[model samples]
Target: MNNPTNSKNPADVVVIGAGIVGLAHAALAVGRGLTVTVIERDDRAVGASIRNFGHCCITAQSGELYDLAQSSRGHWLYFAERAGFWASEAGALVVARNDVELQVLRELAGRREAGQVTVLRAEETTAQLRTAQGTPDPAILGGAMLRDDLRVDPRTTVGKLAAWLQEQGVDFLWRTSAVGFDDGAVHTNRGTVYGRRTIVCVGHDVDYLFPSVSKEHIVERCTLQMSRAAQPAGLTLGPAVLTATSMLRYDAFTEMPSAIELSRTVDSGLQAIGANVMFTQHPDGSLILGDSHTYQHTAAPFLSENTTDLINAEIGALLGMPLEITERWQGIYASSPNGPLLVKEVQPGVTAVSVTSGVGMTVSFGLAERTLNSLFESVHSHRGSS
Candidate 1:
């Protein structure tokens, strides 16, 4: 048995947090031939990794962020094939409930590149999905569009990925909370361990790890509501759904002017309906729907129904057809102020990284690898300078 405490640093690199982003970093560090050790606060892999809808979006993703998202999606598919990973290529559909949403579709269409997102007219969208119906009110002037997004079971995916990492010889420590640390060592609840360098990835719980940086860094925790339903297979509508409210809020559609306006231009009908649905499926055959964003410096107790009611309305607005309700749950993700993400050194050897924004399940792997590279590269550069 190896003792990090005894060795004063048994691992060359120590990563805190075992969430998808942290695990991705562990995997890439292992691949880079570094003696890697991972520490997690929870006994089991939890956090946003297992709590999200698991929609791997690509099309309509704007700026350099698309590159990482594209690469991450590839990694998911690779793991699926290897681990007999359960997944569905059900695709996605963005429904425009108003003229603003329709404008968003047209803008996304004009900008779509290899990401595989496409804009479809009302008839075209109906032709593709065969489920969407009823013409929009002339005042609404909305339609549905197509996006090549994949949905996966975060619960299943995180577990399978954990298994794969162990198979590949990556070291792990569960229920090990890190109280404090810098580059030379990572001090956790289990004991004080050493490493040549360290990376902090506390997610929305950054306040616990890097208290000093938490004040300056624009990282905050966002709590959201989610629910599952026994919607018919035909009710899936063939793809995922991002409502106009979502189109307005999410950059993938809003990066373009028209999409932004549609997002901003609200209709009382939708407001009355509380439309903010982003629909995707799970391997368990349950539909994943929701989300309302509420940020805080500290974690909040799992309570409140306003977000749930609003999310359900969003779900209902898109999947208006009849469906059976199954379960309700809550989740939290890290939200960065803007830009792709920032991974920089807080001190000489201590590095901090957070992709709290963009709900990056779409790019966790690639982002992890990239973050790992920066950490080690800094170590190398430091050595060369010394």
Candidate 2:
């Protein structure tokens, strides 16, 4: 494993998985002047990293997640510039249909600092919807704009970031599966790769590599259905659109006083599906709509049309028109009743970092930053003691 082959061999850091989480760690490692080797099981990231609305739902996070989301916001933009990828500061629009939902938005806006969350009038909110039909949803009372949120093209960001990381001298082992981890080393099917430290960001597949750790954390898979709809005629959306169900999903909004009432107002069918009804428009003008959460120990390899129909119908009503589904996929990420994050030391010099929730896109870079800081500080302190 320690055998030297190239200049980048025996890297300073070895990262497992090439999804956004892994790539983020690799990119940040490079930023710290560390030689990084990334191991991916596939030729490209085809997982939860690419299967999202690309919204960095920043303002909706609370407590530690909020801090991390804010930190991640900067890095997402930083790397986007360095990597020449498309990222927008378009923020997020939370459309409140009824007064209960509008109350939730207003409460959330009041809690945040001025300009961070802006409560909008019904006409202003409806203007942002850009409906292609006769009229927007009449139920739109008012809404709020989450000013710190961001959007990127999930389909392309990972690939471009990976490519740019390679250009920065980070080595990528695509199609290489990491089977095991030892102190300062990663054992893959191809061969053992040595590094000073190893970080595993394998998302839900953490169970596949470290079963005990996965079980100890009560890690399971949370699968959701997402779809892409063709662009509506003459419609262009900037900010990611979130709805009443979204208020139920994010912590910041849920903590509001009106959240319970808002939840009660949500349709029972939506609640049954665990829907977080939201959409973001891609550069191509196609809208990415999704998603309903279903958690289990093992993810079923099937998509429920009934679930999709219910969710899409809800989104269609919000948009005042029916959606033309172009593509659909099931996104599976690590989930736990324990917490939204699992960052544990599996072995000496080996750490496993998994966002045990769906905010992977929102917190990837910031989480990586914290992990690296801890790793480096521990090393510095140990060397000084010795």
- Name the top lDDT candidate: 2
Give the alpha carbon lDDT tens digit for every residue of 1-386 in model 2.
32323334589899999999999888888877788999898899999999989999999999999988888888998888889999999999999888899888889888999999999999999898866663668899999999999999999999999999999999988888889877877878877889999999999999998999999999999999999999877778889999998999999999998898976799989999999999999999999999999999999989999999998988888778888999989999999999999999998999999999999999998898889888875432101000
Best model number under TM-score:
2
Least well predicted 10-residue stretch by lDDT in candidate 2? 377-386
lDDT of 2 at 292: 95
Write the residue-wise lDDT of candidate 1 on 140-180 in tens digits: 23454444566777877777877787787777778788888
Runs in model 1 lying further than 4 Å from the true structure: 1-9, 123-148, 236-238, 267-275, 338-340, 377-386
How badly does each model clash, as a count of residue pairs? 8, 0
- How big is the positional error of residue 148 in model 1, measured in Å on the Cα after superposition? 4.5
Per-model C-alpha lDDT, please? 0.66, 0.89
Q: After superposition, how far is residue 147 of candidate 2 from its true place, in Å?
A: 0.4
